[model samples]
Target: MARRRRKSRGRKLILAVAALCLAAVYPLQEQLTDGGGDSRGAGNAAAEDVSAAASDVFRDGSTLEVHFLDVGQGDATLIRCGEAAMLIDAGNNSWGDDVRDYLEYQSIGDLDYVIGTHPDADHIGGLDVVMEAFDCGTVIMPDYEKDTQTYTDVTDVMEEKGYELTLPQVGMVYELGEAAFTIVAPNGEYGDNANDYSVGILLEHGENRFLLTGDAEEDSEADMLDNGIDLSADVLKAAHHGSRTANTEAFLERVNPEYVVISCGEGNSYGHPHAEVLNRLREMGIKVFRTDEEGTVVATSDGAGITFNVPPSESWQAGEPKG
Candidate 1:
């Protein structure tokens, strides 16, 4: 009887060990199924990846000029400091050639940073063509991955171009010449809504600051406020194409921007630059420029003050002083 009991006890111990092994394997299996290997090391690995990929792109400088391209009905922003250049959100796929022409017009052959604020087609669709036309130093995007064709096209181009991609994390700062571009929102975990998941960037140069809000809605804006981030800026990119769902009055009070740019299409389906949002900005005494109305808006800063340049024939609207 004692011998039989010892054998049964040994068998139970073996079964317990087997169960533990399965439990360990299950997490790794889940990670693999999700895509690539476990993300346990993704955080640590991302820094190195970004450094390696972008090491060749940026150059030190003190002056910077950002062009909020007038890609009708979509968003496409370009940043240039000295010889380094960065492209953020390439508009819609139909605007691919237009984006390429704009880059060529600016003589931007090599891109230090190619940022897709989110996976939405209107924001990232033209990236495939841009990537094909110019050499990219590094591609930064939000953490969430969608299975859309635009996403696939962008990924395929990245693979084809041998470029490594890194997701923009909160507090991650990229120094470009004399300016510091920092990711200020969409930190930690992914938000429930895609618009709320938008990546927000704060570009600082000396005393000048520009806040780029990538369609981030009120929920994300609340998160930013709760975190006590310095939302004040000299210039603001109106969120969600200036939709009624974003740019709350409370959030605007914190930003208190001198100038605001709204990137939206002419007679868009969404009726962007909503009347309520416009009224709020107007109340704050902030100057507003819309791509639909103002061709391409360019804001140049020399560390202390900023100047606005609207396409010829277009007059400055509310806040801009007559030159």
Candidate 2:
């Protein structure tokens, strides 16, 4: 009876161990069968793998960093090429703190270029605050002026800081670190409209190019075309807050950017990022990233290829629309 009980106990122990092994292997087999093992857990694992790839595209050093701050219905772009930095528009007055905080977060101690783009309240409202907060090298604005207090405030700060404002001329080039940029708009003449006088910049780092049109409308774009400037770029900052008033098809065709960025507030009163502009981009199969939807969008380039802060979704990777 003692021998029989010992054998039975050993059999039970072996069965229990086998069951545990099966339990472990079954879940793994089920996972493998589920659409090439792309279960939620597997997907998370894949995401981790991709994250670890660490292209080092945006890290400190020779890499170039461009930040599109979420200023809400306005524009603020910060570009950092190694130790050199440039700020393009600081958004409205209300965004002053946010813009400053962002610059500080990026460890920016001084600014090589502070651009106002235009004198519109939405464009220069925070210029005074930025100028007051940081040591700026040069301030760039259009030749046009506005009669509002917003304009006066920026000038006062510039005067207080003993900074001279330079009117960007067409074909003028600015070299910062390893990057270089050309002023492509406010091209020699001004129109009665403020939007037409907006300054446009084409920044080049290695082979990568970025075009930022600060509310520039079709007239200015036409001037760029007439001047026979190279308009092809990797990215285009859609003008006039993506209003139909700008981003003409001809301009888009000439630029042929792979990606387009539109900056505006969510549910803005102006109904910005008009459908027409989005339609044009979609028709051209260009990828669109919006401030309202994506929050602050940052693009980093190593002078070879560009990378974005957000990764493409799994569905987008698999050639399916994201729900």
Instruction: Choose the strongest candidate by lDDT.
Output: 2
Local lDDT at 234 for model 1: 90
Give the Cα error of residue 207 in candidate 2, in Å.
0.9
Error of model 2, residue 243, in angstroms: 0.8
Q: What is the per-residue lDDT of model 1 for residues 131-152, given as tens digits with 9 covering 90 to 100?
A: 8888899799888888898889
Clashing pairs in 2: 73-265
lDDT of 2 by residue, 1-323 (tens): 11101111111211111111111222222333442211112233343343234323225566787777777789989998988999999888777665775576455789999998989988888777777888999789988889998899889888888999898888999987789999988885665788888889999999999999899888888888887789899999989888888899999999999888888877787777777877888889887767666566667778887766533111211111223
Which one wins on TM-score? 2
- Against the true structure, what is each candidate's TM-score? 0.76, 0.79
